[model samples]
Target: MMDIIDLKKKAAEIRIRLFQMIHNAKAGHTGGSLSNTDILTVLYYHTMRHNPQEPKWVERDRFIASKGHSVESLWCILADLGYFPKSELETFSQFGTRLIGHPNNKVPGIEMNTGALGHGLPISVGMALAGKRDHKDYRVFCLMGDGEQAEGSIWEAAMSASHYKLDNLVGIIDRNSLQISGNTENVMGLDPLDKKWEAFGWHVVSIDGNDIVSLMETFNSIPYTEGKPTLIIANTVKGKGVSFAENAIGWHHRVPSDEELALAIKELTEQIESLVSKEGQPHE
Candidate 1:
């Protein structure tokens, strides 16, 4: 396990990489990606058991980024984990690039091709059921957008997961208040989100999505129930780290101007520096 400080440093780096990739691509989903950075960092760098070299290793834990628009964060983390060269991150959303706007399974570390809203949970349920049937000990983690809860398929999948008693599965909702067009509540009310999942038989946990400590603690609490899946409703801001973008619906699919991108990068760099300095000593 990495020390908490080291993990935090990695999280900051992942955030910087996410901003750079999205800014460079000029056509990626920066808002959702930034909002989920800490969660993905915790999962890829610390919590989940995965083999970057053998992405399809059957015994490896599965992570499905259900809110596929958040692909930038996952792509950066995978590159940092050595699933692919970090240099390849430059091709994100470019013509002929495997790193499309949403995740594609062809990407070295991506487990599923997602981007279509509300598809990830059901697919993850299938994966979890397979693990149960085969008696595999591997766990499955699925990350969904808060707005995605509006989809009826998500509840359907939730019911199926409970019915199958998939204790090995974990669902994480990035409860960032804003979606593309407007606030999620105005677009489609999903208040009482936690209770809905709890009613569906999932063990629910809510946490501050951007706090690394809270994220680690929340993830560590998975598998809390013996016969049920766990659902973590992580309350978050839409564009998490960048001041200009945070919680602003305009950034949802908006391409940042050159000036905005430079500013965003600068802010992320400062965040990385702060975390690195607080680590007491540099990584060897």
Candidate 2:
């Protein structure tokens, strides 16, 4: 297991890199990306069994970015992990770049092209079922946004995943409370979200999505019940790492200004330095 301090350091690095990408691209779903950075850091660095060198390795665990709009964080992680040249991140959202506003299969690590919302879970269910039918041990992880829960297709897919007893499937919701329009509850009430998934037959576990320790622990304990899929309701704050953006509805997809970018970078850098100092490691 990776040390908690190390994981926290990596997540802060990722946040800084992602914000730089967003700042350069001048477009991104800022809040959601920040909110989910820790969740993704744990999965890619600690929980998931994947190889950047052999992206299509049959035995590799699969990840589907269901809430695909907030893909900058994933992009930065993949680049850092050698999925692609780190220099390529500079092309994000540029014309003719594979790193578009949403997940694109053209990228090595992305399992599917998503951003339509409501499609990731359904596709993940199919993948999990396929893994079962083939007798493969590979697990399928699908990350979705809280706002996306309102889509009827999500419920249908939830029902199917449970009915099929796809224990290999793990569904994660970035429950940041805010969405593009406004607060999720104001747009479409989805309180008692965990209970709803439980009713659909998933084994629900709620945790602080921003806490890397919690994320590592939760993901390490997959298929909470043998015959059921696991649903992690990751309660997170939108724009998590940036002081000005944290929990702010306006930051959902808002690009950071030059000053905001500098400030965010400074804040995240301090966090990285703090962690490194405690660990007695020289800051790179």
Candidate 3:
């Protein structure tokens, strides 16, 4: 059984580590990384079944981060889970570090090398299809950004997933709305996003991406429908934790200064403390 409260605390800590990773490295997609933190947290800490000690376990679930630039959070989660030594994080974005700015397959726990915007979903579809053909029980999950929706290849992959009735594939979109250039709608409108997925034959579920409780419940109801791929539209705020960066466009690829890092650290620390105070308490 997964402890919901611990999951919440883990997410907060991951956010702090994620910020530290970028601050030390002096480069990262800050806004997107923070926006998708909760989703990544829930998936790694609660939903997915895998052995960090045996990352290549044959029956383990596969995860692909399609929106690869915001990989700082994922790296933090993997290290915290013991996929690699925590010390490796200090080498992030340095000369010849496996912990680059995007998801890299060379790093253990990552199923594929992504970040090209539209490639993750298609590759995941193929993985799910292979699992079905092999009679394996593993599921494939892909995390993508809202801005990546502009890629036509995503839809084609969606169509293919549904055509194959890939119920084993689940995808979550961090609908933070802001891209590097600006708001997603302004850069490329993707409103009516749910309808578009439904039309493509996916089982769609919309949820508050930041809420651990809600995300856990949603994942429990996966394969929303039989014979369909599930698509979760996780509405999120860009730069989720730090006040100055939340929903701020400039934070997309901006490194935080020392002062900003102090502020972020303080915010994330408080979040963890707050959760600790509520530990073992009943929620109404």
Best by lDDT, which number?
Answer: 2
TM-score, per-candidate, Cα-based: 0.95, 0.97, 0.98
RMSD of each: 2.2, 2.2, 0.9
lDDT of 3 by residue, 18-57 (tens): 8888999998888889999999888988888899999999
lDDT of all predictions: 0.87, 0.93, 0.92
User: What ranges in model 3 sit over 4 Å off?
Assistant: none
What is model 3's C-alpha RMSD? Answer: 0.9
Show pairs that collide, candidate 2: none
Q: Name the candidate, 2 or 3, with the larger TM-score value.
A: 3
Ten-residue segment with the worst summed lDDT in candidate 3?
1-10
Minimal lDDT window, size 10, model 2: 275-284
Ranking of predictions according to TM-score: 3, 2, 1
Model 3 residue pairs with clashes: none
Error of 2 at 110 (Å): 1.0
Residue-wise C-alpha lDDT for candidate 2, range 7-114, written one tens digit per residue: 898899989999989889888989999999999999999999999999999999999999999999999999999999999999999999999999999999889999
